[model samples]
Target: MTTRGPLLAFLLSLVVGLCLTVPAGAVQPDEVLDDPALEGRARALSAGLRCLVCQNQSIDDSDAPLAKDLRVLVRERLKAGDSDEEIIDFVVSRYGEFVLLKPRLLPQTWALWFATPLVLLVALGVILFSYRRRKALAKSPKPLTANEKRRLKRLVNED
Candidate 1:
């Protein structure tokens, strides 16, 4: 009886953990294609495309009407025998590059891609400069004033 209680608790926690860890996709049953290969391709493509209505979520993971539309469109394109690249191009042409979860590296996007690292480097340089300045100041003690030196000399004489 004692062992059963611990076992039940462990099983309950395991089930809850599994439920939390599983991905919650928004793809409906009707949205799935009969052909597993085509469906797999559609899912892969959908995962790369962003849901414009839910900016942070992929179309595959979003429940927005627009995301559903995009998923359906992707499946339709696959059924029409469009290659993955062609479908991606068609969507990109219609919606612009912002629909892509990862934007293509181009001349214009170079700055966009590098901006974070550039900012980080600049911040690191500033931090290092400040640290070095503080260290240098600490290492070299401030010179004693003339009055303080005289006081020290008189104290030594009394000693």
Candidate 2:
């Protein structure tokens, strides 16, 4: 039927949109803590921690087994009465700082954070320098001497 074409297109688009979105419940029911307060802390921590396998997705949004493991580890730390800072420190010690989506501001990391701005400033300087040079070069030439004018006219005739 002619009507089926638009309906099929609408259904396909709806399915595609849903597929592209991150699943809200990547953490299994088993991983949820018994205490709501601890569970909320675990969820918040999971959201900040990057999924090593997925790279871009947070552990809370990633379905990777390693992400699941990390989530469990965070909950376990919470159960043990570790402060949020201590839990993060423990993970960072084991996995290195790459596990964090946002790199810490350390002397070594200063370059990583500043590289983009430095590059942009250098590029702007180069652009401004070249623009000034071109503008400077565009100034009118000194008036040709009578002899030079004669030579130019002669050269034009030869051409």
Candidate 3:
């Protein structure tokens, strides 16, 4: 109805959109360490661990109860003087390696990591072979027999 009304509506929508995009850390205040270094390490590890309930989201980004439990477990392990690797290994053992956002390179995961590239290469080879074969066929002209030429002449005359 008025410029002021439309402008106010636009401003309200902009504020709501900005609020939604603001990154909210899922870690609770009580779980934070006094030592900044340890807290930093805990945060890094949390970022790599996948939330089981929210498969694609990291434990650091997820709001699930299981994610909170994992965050607490990681902090506890850090306080107990566990190395980052040990804490990760403990979680992996408990939940299986699927909990890791980036899986470790090992015999078990070789196919998982390499299968897509292998399949892509195979598909590329097939496409190239098909293209080359089609090109070759096109380049090599087929000799028209006498009957075909006669048929062509008759068809042209009929038209």
Candidate 4:
């Protein structure tokens, strides 16, 4: 009975953990509309936005206040008859390009977009150069003359 009690408790906890409750204030009720298509569009747009409060997570995945605010903003834009691009541009203008999960391919942002690969290539070249230099340093020159070899051996042995 004692073993069964612990097992039952563990199973109950696992079931509770698996139950995904949206939580109070995670999403505002007013943001969702009667029209399923518009709600779906709002959801899709929200998924591409980075939550400022949870920098690595999309607004759709985040439960933070800022994420909720962004979600509402998307729904509001949709309700106002804004096209997807217009809504995205509005958010980008308000929050800067950092709000976008995928940055635009404009001239201003091009260097930032390419910097990571360039830095990686530079790092790889540095590593290769160091490895070659170390290998060169390890390779010994031809053996010295008999007299020189004897002198070197004596000095090394004495040390």
In model 1, residue pairs whose N, Cα or C atoms come closer than 3 Å (at least 3 residues apart or on different chains), thus clashing, are: none
Q: Candidate 2 on 25-138: residue-level lDDT in tens? A: 699999999999999999999988999999998899999999999999999999999999999999989998888888889897899899999999999999999999999999
Model 3 lDDT tens row, 1-159: 679999999999999999888766888888889999999999999999999999988998889999999999999999999999999999999999899999999999999899999999999999999999999988968889999999999999998
Could you tell me every candidate's TM-score relative to the true structure?
Answer: 0.73, 0.80, 0.77, 0.65
The stretch of ten residues in a row with the least summed lDDT in candidate 4 is 19-28
State each candidate's clash count.
Answer: 0, 0, 0, 0
Displacement of residue 158 (Cα, Å) in model 1 is 24
lDDT of each: 0.95, 0.93, 0.94, 0.86
Worst 10 residues of 1 by lDDT: 103-112
Off by over 4 Å in 3: 1-22, 142-159
List the candidates ranked by TM-score, beginning with the highest: 2, 3, 1, 4
lDDT of 4 by residue, 116-157 (tens): 999999999999999999999899987799999999999999
The TM-score between candidate 4 and the true structure equals 0.65
TM-score attained by model 2 = 0.80
Which candidate's TM-score is highest?
2
Index of the highest-lDDT prediction:
1
